[model samples]
Target chain A: MSTAVAHRPGLHSWLTLIRCEAKMVVRDTAGLVVPIGLPLLILVMNASAAGDEEITAGRTALDLYILPLVFTIVTATIGIINMPSFLAYYRRSGILRRLAVTPASPAMVLIAQVVVSLIQAILGIALAFAVAVLAFGAHLPVDLGPAVGIVALSIAAMYALGMVVAALAPTPNSAVAIGLVGFFGLGALGGLFGGRDSLPGPLATLGEWLPFGASVEALSNAWAGQPVEAVHLLSLAVSAVLGAGIAAMFFRWD
Target chain B: MSEPAILAEGLHKQYGDTVAVDDISLRVERGETLGILGMNGAGKTTTVELIAGLRAPDRGSVRVLGLDPRRDRGAVRQVLGVQLQHAYLHGALTVVELLELYRSFYPDPRSTEELLELVELTGQRKTRFEKLSGGQQQRLSIALALAGRPQAVILDELTTGLDPRARRRMWAAVESLREETVILVSHAMEEVERLCDRVALIDAGRILASGTPAELVAQSGAPNLDEAFVALTGKELEIEEESA
Candidate 1:
């Protein structure tokens, strides 16, 4: 074989990969239902439950709390639960190994998954916000800037943790099991079902230090028009860095 | 003489205590089809992977088109196309979509329509990979391997799961790529005899024999390549028992 100089293409190559990945994500309707459908369902249900009941010193209602919780569930479901299963399936099926021989590195696939998950998270948030505003007459955040910042940081932290699960799980089934454990375990600590103060003193203290708890606190504070605690933001940033570092150190291409 | 398209010397690979490839060396000229023939657990797959840069040898040097597979992996990828045994693509992607995605990796890729036609997948372009039959999936894989217009192509067990008719069709598609340096890893003696310019017979991670089909047949004093393979590897009794 003649050894011709290998051609190096630009960004177009990765764009194609991302497009294909997005198409596959769209086709997986069952997977999308949880991220998109569950949030809308929760929004309507929680809004009905509040029904003219004033929560928190007559200034806020249960609907305000539900909005943040719905946002958490949307980001966590896509970032922690959905992303790992897709990546693990790719690894178990030897798709990563196959891509190693081609000009495209397998890392592109991971980027594609992250991109699609972020898109889903954004869509889920948008749907919840629209429903809350139209049907429940919910007030918008006092400062959109900090609210967006908190949401972005929360997504980064959650996805970083998800990458760790994807790196360690040997199979798709194992990925799902581990991801669900992380989801519910973190969800409870973050007060997805109830107030974190309701938990025992030690558990509440531990939750305060965890990424999910930090994210919930930051988002809840932002939605309630209160200044977010600096420690919570720092914890989320720390979790994002540590979780991503661990995942990168142990990631396997095959 | 021109440099060999692929050269490997003193290859040794092991898994735990089991040796997968032991002191095997090979060279293939440009545009030559070299068949690696071996029985089960004979390390043919490992040898191909080493050559393709998918696996690094425990102790060996492999050069493809004058570049080290490990050190020059990016360059090697630009020139090498591989279809691993029992490998898969995204199940939800349609055949055309998968082809287009792979084609984007290469600077000068063959048109997707042409590739679909070459693999006889024109009629099934819109079908998802999971929905396609076994033969169709295999053909799509072969087409994807050729998407880069690779100078060297490695095909492992290309027709293992296909029906006889599909196998013949696959053979024809492979035959069309005769100008590329192709390393075919297979157990089917007839396929090697029909398509290979040279053959390497491996047994227990070692090369038992190497030559053309006629040379091997003549050396073993056998009626055909199949019996000659049995004679060379000394597996005639085991094969006979299995068949009986």
Candidate 2:
């Protein structure tokens, strides 16, 4: 009998897994387009109107309000909606269970998926920025460092919530349904439909504390050359931690 | 004596009020093919799942290649390839792509072309998993199990839904793996009789008998292993018609 133990999967294996994941994400037409297309549509529709309304020295309402909202939409849609559905499908279809038996652990799938989703998110963000600047003449954020930092935090925060949705959802359809509820629930309160000013006082306050509201507010502050509030940052950090904790506790591979 | 490839001692598992596995013990020597014969819901799949470390036994131990499956899962996974009853794979991946991905997971994996030829899937190399026929999908699953060049392999219901032609082809694939330790879980007596060196009859989460096919027939005073199975387990073997 051969007594040789198998070698651990190397970088080549991970790259192949990630490539497969990327292919799946690309092939799913609706999933591929919606996260990028919907946000771009919203950005274009709002950019022309917001472009003429200058908020500070040179930056318009486009930079402070519309750009952040558009970027937030990109991250939230992909992180909260697309990523979880893929995870739910993998679990439902037993793909994760199948990988568990191989030298390639199932955790590798999750990591590969996250990597692909991050790449998709980056593409969406870059596309939105390109259109905003080239097409609508939008300017960069006054505080570029913080704006970039906030967007990264928002991505992490949204992905954490996506993990929770993937954990609780029994099927892909359920994942989409729950993700939509989450995206809109947070969006509506976070000033997606309109600014939080129009919401009920309590809801507006609640929205300010949620990832969507917190991200938009922080990004808006950074764009407007103002200091981001500690409260907004705290909201995003807490959501990320809590969402990860819940997912780790309840997630099932199959 | 050389250590056995697989050993299970008094394995017991339960789900809620249902006892899925109960006090089952087995030992499979290196390079030996052991057939586990049982009807549906006779804990066949559950038994293999325990050996593969997919589920932790409630009250026993399992070791593969002298390593505890649960404790040494990383090492065991390197040597133990499992083909479950379900064809659980990414639906959109083509046969070759899936084979390539699984191949990359092992340091010494069989080439995609080699696996495709082994399962007679060369013609369907570019075909998507969901697009393959049920038999073809089962064959692909078997190929994936063999991709890692595992020393110990477990195939659960390998040909359950296959047509006779496909079943014969699958048997040929198994025959080529005679050098590896194999635990074949199936309801098909013909498959066991042809491929396995020894057979164990199980019923209601317990082993009814264990011996070579001839020995099983002699012990039960039956005409063949099929009749021996019925006499030992007190259950009629129900062979489903070929559907794919």
Candidate 3:
């Protein structure tokens, strides 16, 4: 009956939220398979398909294209699909309602979900990297630190975009369906699948500014140990902010 | 104690053209348990939702412990607990896991084990929310409501569809709690008669009578709460007329 000044033990509180979300994510294996297995399959195909014929950009290799698709896959999986589904699930289950009445901040809930999705993206990258190395003879990235940065940026943007999609969708299923379309559509447009050279100049230019494309460019630059362009970072930052804002406006707990 | 734990004035809610909760006002004081009796579509749920801050009333205001439920939701929420009928938790999560998770929300949550023991679900702590029987789920729900140790608890038709023994168990469980205030929305007049200190008999979204059990029975010249309710509302003879 009394509202005491609610306090938690610092990072442990945030970390506990993250850990709980991660446990739920891992326990729901059906959700995990989509993000992980698909990326591995694509990595193998690209490594096998690597050739002059597969190179659309004059100096680009097939695996280079896979970098952006990695993010596209991650974005679709977490940002678009998982965001709405989980939000709806929480709202319906009264988990959000209970949490709404609690001392825990909504920002923390946002962070926990993003962390869970980021962990999944990490697993995807690890899986792809393993496939590239063992199955397709991919030489690993020279720069570990930069690669890590790229992964982090790519995941952050994807997570944010996912939040936007989840907020906009009418229902959880609708969010997932629409999210997948945009998820894969942008990836394909960003020259993930192939045939970028045949596209109109305006369309190709527009594609470069799209979410995963910009992220892929930054990540690939990072993997090559080259300094990342500030534009890429800015684009990602914008997507994230916009996404978080949308989630704040529309995210319902009860 | 001068101010009631709950108070509402001119509460009106509309979903487009449908007036769900039509201009209702009621109040409950500290240590008072108010039972609301209404049939389906009588605006019971809407009224409860309005008071609970689950929905924003289109007109008028609601205050729980002197704080507006809508405007001061977080502050008021910390002070009030609600257990809605047929409300459920995550199916995959065990009762213990659920209790632990819910505990994280409250600044000073009750001991999970003690709550389970109090609800008589101590042995079923490992059971998932879906795994428990209907009665067990109801008990766990009461346990969850008690989690925050709130000043007021609102139970929306807590005993509907429950068997006799289960209903009795729930009543006993509720009685043992030393709640400052409890508002029960139920159709069962006997359930209200058994547990409530006071009740508001509502029909068509308006309070028909408000008093102690014996007072209502005596005022209506009825043998019991049911007959009293039927007499006060004047709906029983209408049913009889329809049946005839």
Using TM-score as the measure, the top candidate is 2
> For residues B1-244, could you state the per-residue lDDT of candidate 2 as single tens digits?
7778889999999999999899999999988999999888889989999999999999999989888887877788889899987747988888998999999988889888889999999999989898999899999999999998899899988898889999999999999996899999988989999999999888999998999999999999999988999888888998963322
TM-score of each: 0.96, 0.97, 0.86
The local distance difference test score of model 2 is 0.90
Which residue segments of model 1 deviate by more than 4 Å? A1-3, A51-59, B236-244
Clashing residue pairs found in predicted model 3: A79-A162, A80-A162
Which portions of model 3 miss their true places by more than 4 Å? A1-16, A48-63, A105-107, A134-137, A140-147, A198-202, A225-235, B236-244
lDDT ranking of the models: 2, 1, 3
Cα-based lDDT at residue B189, candidate 1: 75
Error of 3 at B209 (Å): 1.5
Using DockQ, give the best candidate's number: 1
Misplaced by over 4 Å in model 2 are A1-6, A170-172, B241-244
- Predicted chain B of candidate 1, TM-score versus the true chain B: 0.96
The pairs that clash in candidate 2 are none
The models' CA-based lDDT, in order, is 0.85, 0.90, 0.72
Please give, for residues B70-157, the per-residue lDDT of candidate 3 as tens digits.
7776677677888876566656667887777666666777899889878888888888777889788888888878787778888887
User: Residue B82 deviation, candidate 2, in Å?
Assistant: 0.7
Per-residue lDDT of model 1, residues B131-154, tens digit only = 999889999999999998888899
lDDT tens readout by residue for model 3, A43-139: 6666676623333223245445565466456555666667667776765566666554444655577678777777777777777766665766555
